[model samples]
Target chain A: MKGGLFTSGYGPILIVVVALAVLPFGFSANTTLNFLGFVLIVTLAAQGWNLLAGYGGQFSFGHAAFFGMGAYGIALAQVRFGLNPWLALPLAIALGALTGTILGYLSFRARLRGSYFALVTLAFAEVFRILANASTFTGGAAGVLIPLRIDAANFQFADKRSFYWLALSFVAFVLLLTHWIARSRFGAYLVAVRENEDAARALGVDALAVKLKAITLSGGITAAAGCLYAQKFLYIDANLAFGPWISVEALLAPIIGGIGTVFGPLAGAVLLLGLGEITKTFFTWLLGGAVPGIDLVVFGVLLILCVAFAPRGVLGVLRRILPAFRGGRA
Target chain B: MGVRARAILSHGSMMLKFDIFLSALANGLLTGAVYALIALGLTLIYGVLHIINFAHGATLTLAMFAVFVAHQAFGLDPYIAVFILTPLFFVLGYALQRAVITPASHGDDGNILLVTLGISIIIENALLAIFRSDTRSIDVPYGFSVMEVGPLFLSTPKVIAFVATLAVAGLLWLLLARSDTGKAIRAVAKEKTGAALCGIDVAHIYAVTFGIGTACLAIAACLLMPTFLVNPRVGNAFVLVAFTIVVLGGMGSIGGALAGGLIIGVVESLSGLYFGESLGQIGIFLIFLVVLLFRPTGLFGAKA
Candidate 1:
């Protein structure tokens, strides 16, 4: 285990943690901290999605269902039961895991795979969004306020710096956990199944169990991000929690970074989220207000270009570049 | 509780029930025809290419805008614009498949999916930029006309839409069954290599197949103009329904698409009436899930 901890993935994660710790001091801008927090939250979600879709090959288009479930779960628990946000956070995670397990079991047991799996997930997301919109408990289309402002006891942070630290910690924890899982026995079994399910099954891997476990874990982690998002934003809406745009963003990150790798989400989060912020600022600067729908158009075009040209992603490009440095050393 | 009295009362309630049932069925059939026209293009492309064309909705929207422009600028009827637009769309579709889609189709499903998704995004945003997001409908002078028979009422536009659907579907069926080019297309769908060996131009068949699929949307767009408020995002609603229909019909089965469309339409209409409007979409998804669970091959799909 110690030997495994010394791998390249862990080294970068440690560097990331150190950088995050110093970031607040170096950048006093509250807006910058806010942006960083948003990126970390997105990174967590993307990593969670990569576990299942990238590693397990399940390709879910309904991950937003889990995200929304987590957000609404926390909101409902806090508003109705008078529970603390921290207490409700666990419940939110459990809700996501439960829903993910049920969905995975149903779809996998029925032998749904590939495009069918994606369609089923998408259908569920649509259903959940529609339900969220109609339910008065969800505050209907107007959405629900968090009911409490930032109080440490309430699991809300009043300061952007505090939110950034909280988000950074979560990102670090998830990254470490994901790295550990990728090297564990179960992780090996998952990769085996991904490469060739039939062969993995013949070699005594319970393919269904492995996939279900990955899905459950992925869903739980993604929902945790949702919980954080609700606390940070102090509001929850069906569109924010269950939007198809969230799913697209989640899928795009890992694909652009280096799918099925530990640092993929981190790399992707940096590039995509950075570009996104820059684009927003640029558009606002140039057009007076952000050009409506231009970000999506650009993002969509980027996704196509990435798929066409860089199938292996930026990390893959880095891998190719690293050899040149080693050759120079030699 | 006398037999004659009970029998008479039973007959009276049965007649009343029958009337309600028939009216509901008629309403469902009319809507189903519109759904079938939209779904036909989707299933046709899926059948021939094995790629789920995510841009089908966007393409339909583009055609809708074309009709709207023709109506506003040239004083042509929306229906008349179909004749001009359908063939034009066919050529566009053919070119797209040949130049873009076919190269990406070498069993790499992900590339094709992303490409179509990109196309959808591009078209939708471009339309939004050009036309804005305001709702536009071509309201014919006779759009509000209706036919009444006994106790039932039928909208004239709906009836025409249904007839147009049937005529287009029948024409497609005839083409596939009787025409040599259509036969070649079907052969290519069945076995690409075998068709090529038999001297069929496989690439041309693929292009033509996509052409026919896009042409089907022209009819659907014109039919939908009177009923629906056309806008940049109008396609989003139909995309999901069409996907559900295609999956329920059995992938790559034209007859199955027709049957599945009717089933979904009826189910949606009845659920909307009995339950609520929001529940109608939920009902459609539930049916999709159940079908996937119990009959993975779908109602008319061939065994993999």
Candidate 2:
């Protein structure tokens, strides 16, 4: 089992590393790095979502709140307390976990299950967006720009290569963490809880506690991605951080990839971001200009099609293709 | 003499406060009537289907656009265009329900939600593609006309909207209470298998129920066109508010929907007046959270 898992996982991880190393050299410095950074951050977020919705069986429509909180946590710490970005990173993760815990506790305490849980999560995110938009602390609707000049100590990389490396490291870390968790006892509990909450509870699983644990962990990781996103972009705002689109993208990636699988988010982010870039470039080439909202429309359509036909996702498809690669199959 | 004069002034001041309260109450009622109209279809669909039609706002927008096109192409008044558009929308609703929605609603609530969300995206984007995201509004001849009752002034468009709301609500109530078809719909809403066992055409009624729900949007759109600008994204705001209202009123309760819409409207108006404009939606959301925390089944909802 271990050998099979390592072989299947190594294929994609090796491919990603090789591609990352070769592509930056071939492509434009700014464009390739920017895309890579986006993919990394989104992959991290999608993984978090997969843990909650896909594995834990508690669909949260408001995971963006964690991301936004993470971004704001770092931004606030850096701005107010003169903290280094590296120092602020852990703080953001903690805050993200706290937010997730509060949300999970409140909703779970009320016994809000299934779709109600999803909607409440969505409402919480929306409420956060509204608060972010209204508050002076978050810089309101216009958002905040980090004053840090790019440097190694500040965690702000001066060159695109440095940013790419940092982002890649983050993505790799999240991927490994996800793999570890999936194999752990906690993971089995999550699967049991998802499969049948009542049965799991009957068997002394403490379903709520398991779900809250998954959500807390998921939220923390997602928030870490937000910190990375803020660092990469050098700016943060309510719209960018807490927007419904972020939540939608996070959910879509996992669903499009195989939701319950460890490497599903990575597969999803690559497919989605790749297709999105291709479509964007093609449209730009055709029009000699950009069309606003076309990408969104396409993404929405793709999501619908995927949900309608392939609920199991791209990784699910890959699993079928590589039947010999069934080691880590969820 | 001075004490008597002061007492008279105090009594007069109390009358003024009473007058102000009365006016606010009247305005709240009017606003509530409009909310009822917007939320009625949402409640009906939720009641019968047990699915939240996230695309209800998009359907409303489409119906509004249809009316706009009719008004532009044929030079027809919006009130008159409603007659033509309502049936067209009904048919469209029926086809949509039968073809797209029913297959998706099979035991999986998530699938139903996704499918509707997909339809919403498609409809919204289609509108964006065709209309180019430009805001459109009807320049009605009597849009600004108003009637005065003592010190209170009521806009003609708003009054007409209110009247239309009552008319539509009454018709729906009659259909549900008096008509055989309405009874069948109620039967379906109550119990699908039992309705089928009772020799009711469940599928046909489901399609018709959807059609009726969409037709409610037709009336709502016509009523709103003169007063508000129509845009591709406008549906989103309305959809959120409608959802809040539906949840507040309890899922699948038409009367509850009516009351819930009124409560939301009044809350919105008061919030806007007291807390300023930007905070209005925030206020509503706060109320929604409070309600969800305390009474998830809603105030008027039947016990689950």
Find the candidate with the highest DockQ and give its number. 1
On a 0 to 1 DockQ scale, where is model 2?
0.41
Q: Considering only N, C-alpha and C atoms within 3 Å, which residue pairs clash in candidate 2?
A: none
User: The CA-based lDDT of model 1 is what?
Assistant: 0.81
Q: Per-residue lDDT tens digits of candidate 2, residues A1-330?
A: 345635546555655566766666777568777887798889888888988888888877788999999999998899878998899999999999999999888888888877677767877887888899999987898888899686799988778877777777777777777766776888889999888888998999988898899999889988988998998887888879998777877887888887887777878888888887887788789888765556667776777777766778887776778986565453
lDDT for B17 in candidate 2 is 65
Runs of candidate 2 exceeding 4 Å displacement: A2-23, A26-28, A284-289, A322-330, B1-24, B72-74, B104-106
Q: In candidate 1, which residue ranges exceed 4 Å CA deviation?
A: A1-8, A281-289, A322-330, B1-21, B104-106, B301-304
lDDT of 2 by residue, B1-304 (tens): 6543454465577776665565666666676777788789888987887777877989888888887787777887888888888888889889988988777555577767767776777788778766768999877798777777665556777788888898898899999999999999999998999999999999899889888888888888888787778888888777767777878988778888888888888888777766777798888777777677668899875542
Cα miss at A85, model 2 (Å)? Answer: 1.7
Q: Candidate 2: which docking quality band?
A: acceptable
Candidate 2, B173: how far from true, in Å? 2.0
